[model samples]
Target: MENQVTQLLKAMVKPDYTACSYAFMQDGKIVCADAIGVIDKINNQPITTDCTFNVCSISKIYCTVCVMQLVDEGLIQLEDKVA
Candidate 1:
């Protein structure tokens, strides 16, 4: 199952999707970590496991964590009006 996913990712490489990273975590630990693509466009480098990808959007779970943190700090009330 894991190898199939890895192979599929490798076969789907493109200039637009030049950088991609995948982490398979199970029971709170990463079981498999794989990355493919370019490290830098200027040098036309290939992306490797060590290369970092930028995550631009906040996921729903991340938003929930931020809300919980704000609640813990008493910065906002649950019933407070959102701006």
Candidate 2:
């Protein structure tokens, strides 16, 4: 299963699609966080695990964490919204 996912990622790369990152989650734990491709064209090289990538949509994870904390404290109803 993991190998197939990796192969699929490698197959998806393109000149324009220079970088990619993925995280595997299990039981709410991040088991794998990896990336591939180049950071800068001037120093063209594949991205490494240590490289920082902009986690754009992933900013919602913090929101989720905050919501979970609210739930834990019994401070929010399931349908509550911040306004």
Candidate 3:
């Protein structure tokens, strides 16, 4: 499975794609983690699993989870406006 994933990632990076970092977890423990390609095209710095990316949509999921947790704790109501 890991080899297949690595091969797939290698195939992906061959085109216009810049880089990728992925991790699979089971029971809160990471089963596999992989990173590929350069961090910057100019300098050709390699990226690692620890490197941060500006993942835009993922923040929405995190915000939703936080709001749901607040609702569960009776700290906020669903009808409340967030501003």
Candidate 4:
């Protein structure tokens, strides 16, 4: 499975791409973690699974889901101010 995933990533990597990282988890435990390509294209620094990424809009979706969960639990009101 990991070999297949790596092959897929290698195929997807383009000349313009710097790096890619992936993790697969089951039951809250990581089953596979891999990183490919360079962290700094200029310096040629390699990336690792431990590298941090700015996940942008995905964070907003996570926050919205968390707020919705709180509303479902009657811990927060939808009309309430976030601050």
Model 1 steric clash pairs: 37-47
What lDDT score belongs to each candidate, Candidate 1 first? 0.80, 0.78, 0.88, 0.92
On the 0 to 100 scale, the lDDT of residue 53 in model 1 is 55
lDDT of 4: 0.92
Q: For residue 69, what is the lDDT in candidate 4?
A: 100
Best by TM-score, which number?
4
**Error at 19, model 3, angstroms:** 0.6
State each model's C-alpha RMSD to the native: 4.9, 4.0, 3.3, 2.4
lDDT of 1 by residue, 10-83 (tens): 89977777777788899999888887778788898877777765665657778889998999999987888888
Q: Give the TM-score of candidate 1.
A: 0.61
Error of 4 at 81 (Å): 7.3
Q: What is the TM-score of candidate 3?
A: 0.67
Of the candidates shown, which would achieve the greatest lDDT relative to the real structure?
Answer: 4
Per residue, candidate 4 scores C-alpha lDDT tens digits across 1-83 of 88899999989988699889899999999999898888898888999999989989999999999999999999999999966
CA error at residue 63 for candidate 4, angstroms: 3.5
lDDT, candidate 4, at 18: 85
TM-score of each: 0.61, 0.58, 0.67, 0.72
Model 2 per-residue lDDT tens digits across residues 31-71: 87767678776689878767786778788998889888989
* Residue 55 lDDT, candidate 2, scale 0-100: 70
